[model samples]
Target: MTVRPITITGEPVLHRPTRPVTSFDEELRQLVADMFETMDLANGVGLAATQVGVDLRLFTYAFANDDDAPDRGVVINPRLVLGKISEEDPDRDEEAEGCLSVPGLSFPLKRAEQATVSYQDEDGVQRRFEAHGWFARVMQHETDHLDGKLYVDRLNKRWSAKARKAIKREGWGVPGNTWLPGRDEDPFGH
Candidate 1:
């Protein structure tokens, strides 16, 4: 498997809604493998097809576990069918998340505590799986990417401020000396 370069924040493809995958050909399978490779190499838990400049609705995610174990796999044309809500918002449990596209920076974000998702597995078999805790968060994060969303958009005001400053300092979207604070930071800070 080959590692594909991840597209950065300014790339228009990252925001464009992904097209559904129509074929599960060898190329698509290989792409999934390569995505896993790249994600592993970059120490990312999830990656979306659009992050690699592909417009298809595909993603790979791995649950973060000790012993350096990799629970790696893919989802093709996946759709979220259900989620569980605890008395506490699962996503409000803040943890540091990093992205392959947005390199060299890690910031805090919240993710769902539990979720039940139904999607087509690699062999075109329909599968329904229940996940909670870290696995649920990974699924939520990667699935959001398929819908053209990013975790940074979920940061609270204080966290968003810090994240935006770091993103800008890393030169993510702006030319040298250009400061676009409002666009750079999460205005809503939800």
Candidate 2:
């Protein structure tokens, strides 16, 4: 397993929609293994194929906890089955978010309250999981990467302005439309 370099915002590959994996054979399996190593090396909870220069619908993540236990996983050819928002969702936390691709930039953004997602494991097995709170947020963040979407694009105006300023001052590559302005709606099929 090797740690792959993450592609930043300016990379054209990051903007391309990922292709679905047609086979879960040895090569794909090895990529997943390497992805786990890379995610750990970068101190990230999740890493998507696109971020690592592979245009496939694959991602790996471990849930963050105080114990810092390893919960490494691979989601191959994952697809969204269901998603929704909650009434209890706190409106737009100013918590900073970082990306493996967009290194040196940690910006605050708004995300979903909860999410129920289904995806296939590396072994060709199917699984559906419900994630709320932080876990839900992680799921959404990773899912966005798969769809060629970044968290910075989802921020409200005020937060986005601050993030934009930071990127500019640092001479960082802040992709245009980094945050899609407006109220976010569910991106899942009913």
Candidate 3:
């Protein structure tokens, strides 16, 4: 598997909705493998198809759950169901989120504390999984990608303005802006 360059936020592919995964074949398997590799190399919890310039409704995640248990898998053609969000989070600072597409910058955003995702695996087997706390955020974030929304898009005014400045400073948000995980300098500074 090869590590693909993750597209920056302004790319058209990331702005539009992704197509659903239909054939669970060898090609799909290869793509998932490559995405996992890319996500790991970039030290990301989750990576979506649009981030890698693929317009499919699939994402690979490899991160410990909210309970510190190892949770890793690919979600294909997912439908995410979210629980109520607590607006007044005492640990609100912990909710700051970043994206591979946006590279280094992070901004605090509200997200559901619980989520249930119904999806298919790489083999096309249907499955449903529930997540709580930060894992729920991961699921929600990745699901947003499939619908052409980025974490930055959901940021509140204060953070959104700051995020916009950062994007402009980095010369990102343009088509064809990408960085290879290992080869290129990490904009987020690892």
Best by the lDDT measure: 3
lDDT of 1 by residue, 15-88 (tens): 66788887877888888888887666655678898887788888888775432223766877777644644433
Better of 2 and 3 by TM-score: 3
**In terms of TM-score, which candidate is strongest?**
3
Compared with the true structure, what per-residue lDDT tens digits does model 2 show for residues 1-190? 7766666675665766788888988999889988887676666789888887788988999895332223557776666544554434224444567776655566665556566667888778887766666666777788888888777766667767876776567555644322110222211111
RMSD of 2: 9.1
Tens digits of per-residue lDDT for model 3 on 95-166? 899898988788888899888889998789998888888888999999999999999998877888999999
TM-score, prediction 2? 0.77
Error of 1 at 174 (Å): 5.8
- Candidate 3, residue 6: Cα displacement in angstroms equals 0.5
Off by over 4 Å in 2: 64-70, 81-94, 169-190
> For model 3, what is the C-alpha lDDT against the true structure?
0.89
- Local distance difference test values of all predictions, in order: 0.68, 0.68, 0.89
User: Is candidate 1 or 2 superior in lDDT?
Assistant: 1
